[model samples]
Target: MSTHLLSRHSHRPRASLSLLTRGAAITPAITLERGRAHEACGPARRSFALWLAASTQGPVLWITPQWQPVTLNPDGMMDFADPARFLFVAAPRREDQLWAIEEALRSGAAPLVVADLEEPPAMTPVRRLHLAAEQGGSLGVAPLALLLTPGSGGAAGIESRWHMSPAHQGRQRIWQLDRLRARTQPPACWRLQQKAPRSGLQLCPAPQADLPSEGPHLRATQQ
Candidate 1:
């Protein structure tokens, strides 16, 4: 057999267990339910996306819209993931992103895929992505579709949906997580923070949730 043929046929098998949500409060059991699209929404969308991806094996395919104000920073990614394990595809058109994301999911080439769509995509594209994620499931990976949409509202046909935004106290890097929709559970919220790679996401206790919510955390931190 030719090396090319072998390479094409190869698959890196992994366990198909429920994924860790890395949430707090009622979200401790909130999961990256296998074979489904789980939407994440809010201003700190990237953090929500990376937090989920950090829990999976990588060489993750991160697809984002070209016009997004935020771009991937290698130094910043280090706090949550391996900079090298990520392969990014910046699509200039939302249409192109739809095709690329579905292809990546259907190919079963990567253990996880994150797509930061440019807008709230219609049901057709999201449904297709959900189906592709399901096909990838048979190959071994739980294959989560983590979409970073714009606000508290979520996409249709998603297995689960979450919302998160940066939370602050002076310069502390904390985030608030909310599981807005899920098949197995109702909405829940949590306070979260980054942890060592092997430790993944950790829950920040309630005693600390009393941070100032007077202004947007992003605006405060950028000053």
Candidate 2:
């Protein structure tokens, strides 16, 4: 093929949505490509989702199962984003939850769409979400779809997968964040903490020995 044709076929650089505060000394800003679906698992998955919501501007569309026993506490969400900024979509069934997520992504109205899922969905639905996000991006804003799964997330075809859990030591509030899977990044770990209330978050390397094993808890603290 001619050089011109090759250039036309080459992949273009993609836009990314920042997922965390950029105050970490050695760590670069962790971001997910816009118009893609990502996964967050582990004990603090809800907290991870809240962190993502805090990083973005505009309204957030959060979809969860209506029958789920526990719901997001407004007081708990205050540390991240304003609870009033979130528009909740409570789906009555599993399939409805996925459908709501798909529609929200396709609409491109909200910059972030979060699905608090008990478990991860299959590859086919994930692909559909990717397509919907791409279409939404073309129409207006490029929405980022996040799946909050319980335990060790095993969602297939996701742009990336992250696991976070509490690593508190006495009075200090800390969490261990692991980039378990990514297409372009290798596995890595970090210790995330805030110096004070309403202060910027800090990230530092976590010692291998300090990393905690996956716990059975699904609920995350408001911190």
Candidate 3:
């Protein structure tokens, strides 16, 4: 059998196991009493933490030019309103910051870590981050989807890269998300409409129905 097929098959059983584990983690009574109902839905119904927080749950460890860690969340919130859940550490330069990031990835406490520096990361660094995430069971969001702003370098180690430009439609802000690179998928774009107050985001006009049966693939990829 092909590698992809093997991966798909292996993923099926693991998905079910993952659901059971996550469900058990969330609620023990539900897993025991309503286990049949849970099993009936299969593994598809479990809420994946990474899936739940896509773009929103960033205790984003962003590396600055000075190598300082400037953490930012999805809503552009930064630094300690809540100290226990979020942390922002500053380093002096890119190299130092990357080292700190690797350490954090190894720690696995932070859900998402982002590096924003001037130079593109070496493949080794990228691979290291990937390994750390896989080992630690966390997700890594890299050079893509991160607003590099003025001094950001070219893409490296990123599975997908996006360039976002903000435009206005009347009073609303329409952010265009353009894909720079996406492996194993076609380059695609979307216009995100941001709602106020809670700042909830949704894809405008809905995505193409023919794409995939899974919930928004892009969101999954980003997480």
Decreasing TM-score order of the candidates: 2, 1, 3
Worst 10 residues of 2 by lDDT: 214-223
Q: Alpha-carbon error at 186 in model 3, in Å?
A: 1.1
lDDT of 2 by residue, 109-156 (tens): 999999999998999999999999998899666999999998899999
Q: Please provide, for model 3 over 124-171, each residue's C-alpha lDDT reduced to its tens digit, 9 standing for 90 to 100.
A: 776666555555443432211121422223445555444444444654
Largest lDDT belongs to which candidate?
2
RMSD of candidate 3 to the truth, in angstroms, is 14.0
| lDDT digits (tens) for residues 1-223 of candidate 1 | 6455434556643333233443433434756665677787776677666666667765789897777665677766677667788898989888888898888888888877888875667788889988898798775665777777776755877777887776755555667877787776777887765444335556667434435332221221121
Question: Which of the predicted structures, 2 or 3, would earn the higher TM-score when compared with the native?
Answer: 2
On TM-score, the leading prediction is 2
Clashes of 1: 0
Candidate 2 Cα lDDT to native: 0.80
Q: lDDT (0-100) at residue 90 of candidate 2?
A: 83
Candidate 1: clashing pairs of residues: none
Supply candidate 3's per-residue lDDT for 124.
77
> How many steric overlaps are in each model, in order?
0, 0, 8
Q: Under the 3 Å rule for N, CA and C atoms, how many clashes does model 3 have? A: 8
Q: All candidates' lDDT scores?
A: 0.69, 0.80, 0.38
